[model samples]
Target: MTTEDERMARFARTPAGQRGYDAAEVDAFCERIAAAFQGSTMLTAAQIREHEFAAAAFGHHGYDRDQVDDYLDRACVDLEYARRGDSPHPGPERLSPRDVQRLRFSAPPPGRDGYAAAEVDTFLDVVAATLAHAGPTGLSSQDARAIDFCPAEPGGPSYYADEVDAFLDVVVRTLTEQEQKHTAS
Candidate 1:
């Protein structure tokens, strides 16, 4: 087996009494992931992101849930680059939907102006969806550049403008790079 194959199979199982992802289901999924890596199957990043596994408990202890999720998150990024005919190794600059999902920004200090919390969060959800299923029909870098959230009303919850803009820049660059690669091919 290749290094990637070993990696896929290396997820630790949950302890004896704890609930975790079903071992059988996770193992089967890993086999599919390995097949995809070997170019024997077609599996998109979105599919990886959306996959669900049954839960296991007691003597049937399953794989650690966090480990499986984290590994799958990385696999989705690598698979996305592979699908684009780019190097199979996703560069550090690439942003997976998981990355976007985990992003958190500090709320602005009292009396400071910032983007509306709900609006920014909503936009981020769209951005994550775009990354998960990017295509001609999905949101593009241009769309990201054009997004303008409403400013938070005074005393209302808000995200720091600088942080939001920085993250948006990263999103734009990631989308633009993906588009470039697709066009080049």
Candidate 2:
């Protein structure tokens, strides 16, 4: 089997003229990830989930951002399961209040259609508050499912709809699990 170093060495580079993550920074972080897998480092899944790298300098090609992010997501999940001594494959994990509070979505390119940023942020605030309270005085999973944001005005600031929607799925599952636990007690 290929080692982590070998796998990361093959990460795709951004196209010429396109900015991407700083290659050196990503490589350093990947080294930490590899160390974590080997039990030589203390990197946590949350750290992996929240890690960010600077953009490559002008005229420098960098690793593809999307590719790195997807790999990090899988790595985060794997690390979490590994810590739990569980199966390598895991379902979506629940989020804590802090996790919800820290969530962010990338904006679409200028002039592209997307969800209004303010609406999504406000809703996340409510979700975080609810989670912080452990299922009282907040929204239910169904409520979250029914929520909607206005379309961003043409050329205005907005969050990518797909990213927000995927995050909502996680939020809904978390809330649903909380509600079930609350009712069971």
Candidate 3:
């Protein structure tokens, strides 16, 4: 028998022997298994069957499926250890007021169209309150800079300058018409 064949036969006899696989082949198999099981809560019966097929395909010639699976389970635990980055040692730190403000505004508004103007005002008020207690946290930087650079309101300082002005014009015209009708009657 060839060396690979002999190894396979030996693996079939041992409890944990994967028989025909080299270390690199075993590592590759472990990576594939990890990818397949990503985000899985628990393997289903169907998934177990699929894994059995995979084991058969990857196993050394004459190697039993159960032995391949047993090796695979240990390989998966090793793969998980590889996936989790090196554990950090405990370190010292100081909690600043800026950290508190960061915690406060970290959650953005939810939903498709985002917050309405009223909701934005409420959020700004909360942020302002947080800054007041904690000191200036650069909360209104964007609005303050924009106001300093471009101070004009939406209608360019005229009541009848734009769509909002046009809408107001229409409202006034409708009220005048109603008043004229009342006078005529």
| The candidate that achieves the highest TM-score relative to the unseen native structure | 2
Model 1, range 79-139, lDDT digits (tens) per residue? 6556666545434357777767766666765666889999998888888897888676588
Q: Residue 69 lDDT in model 2?
A: 75
Q: Highest lDDT: which candidate?
A: 1
| Candidate 2: tens digits of C-alpha lDDT, residues 17-108 | 99999999998888888888778879876667657899999999998987887667656645655676654533334566666665656776
TM-score of each: 0.50, 0.51, 0.21
lDDT of 3 by residue, 59-79 (tens): 434345445554443333222
Clash counts for all predictions: 0, 0, 0
Ranking by lDDT: 1, 2, 3
Question: After superposing candidate 3, which stretches have Cα over 4 Å from the reference?
Answer: 1-10, 13-50, 54-61, 86-185
Scored against the true structure, residue 110 in model 3 reaches a CA lDDT of 26
C-alpha displacement of 162 in model 1, angstroms?
0.5
Decoy 1 TM-score against native? 0.50
For all candidates in order, the CA lDDT equals 0.74, 0.73, 0.32
Off by over 4 Å in 1: 1-92
Please report how far candidate 3 places residue 43 from its true position, in Å: 16
